[model samples]
Target: MRQDRAIRTRNLILESMASLFNEVGYDAATIAALVERTGLTRGALYFHFASKEDMARAVLDEAVTREGLSPQAFKLQEWVDLGLLLAHRLPREPILRAAIRLAVDPKARRLFGTRWPDWVALGRELLTEAKESGELLAHAEPAAVSRAFVGAWTGVQLVTEDLEEKLNLSEEIAGLYELLLPSIATPAVLAKLDLAPYRAERLLRKSCGQETPEHE
Candidate 1:
């Protein structure tokens, strides 16, 4: 119906704005430029969004919603789902990472600035779930553990991001999977992690030798 078109048009506008946001920082983005990029006149733009700030808010909500999808609506489950989702789609959608950086802008404080707290909450939830399943270190503090894991993963992605093009992602993950796999799990559960993600593992396998301490 008419409402559907409005939502769809809003989404189109948000998507155009996100593309621009990724290229330039959020403060630098402008309504006129957005209009030019989206091929929508000022009137059409206003019809869908009250103002440029409104459009930015809409874009943040859309990005968060997309990243926050956890299959079911449970908040904790959403955190874990976020992990899998990031793992599966990150190579293809580097913009998601860029979007997270933009979340911290003061002017857009409502959107990205509070994500660190969200990350803290996410860390607590995920570790709590893992503990309930009897899968964590016996004395692990959920907050500390969660923060460590999320921080490490986030930092690693930042560090290794450039490696994706120069190196093969799947093969690399497979190799790392073969190593980190054991630390996080028992032999039984660890067996289930796909080693295709760890690049070193594939290379070691090709060499037909046991994994060394470094890559392992």
Candidate 2:
């Protein structure tokens, strides 16, 4: 029980710090602000994180993995699932939003570095598998395509967030897939792909055993 409580407290601190960092850039998000946001004393906050940099690093660490994705018959489908899950989750998850902000900030990025390499590595791995399984076109290069995809995904999110009309990120990312897949994937595999914006939410629900009815 003590371990569980300690884990919960640590998570609370990280989540609160993430929100603070997202609202205010890394340089502006102070220890006092985090303490106020989490309703915890300085000592309590210090117990979980030695400094603000420490908290920021913790949040960035969580940004590397695809948390809600599952294996699919086509490795390219897994890759799409990963991107869609992030698109669906990033708007609602402060940790992810904060990580992206920190990664793109010149000062913060210099001090802590970004998770772009890690994401690129994961993408390359999946795309390589897809190519080996004949899902990709004969001339497609996994390394190059993966790097480009990461760049495109980041650009889409940043632009969508800045839009005056408040566009849906999931839809934008799905459209990105539609635009890019033809160049990377074979025609048959491309035709089999599900690029719907709502697919991420439905896949996540199905994974959790709370699958929504099709009629809904």
Give Cα-based local distance difference scores for all models. Answer: 0.56, 0.90
The candidate 2 region of ten consecutive residues with least summed lDDT is 207-216
TM-scores of all candidate predictions against the true structure: 0.66, 0.93
Tens digits of per-residue lDDT, candidate 1, 82-183, equal: 454455455655345445546646656654453556666766876577666655546656787566656655555555655546754444433443444345
> What is the TM-score (0 to 1) of candidate 1?
0.66
Which regions of candidate 2 are displaced past 4 Å? 210-216
lDDT of 2 at 110: 98
Give the Cα RMSD of candidate 2: 3.8
Give one digit per residue, the lDDT tens place, for model 2 in 1-216: 999999999999998888888888889999888777888999988888899889989999999866667778899999999899999999988899999999999999999999999999999999999999999999999999999999999999999999899799999999999999999999999889888999999777776664543222
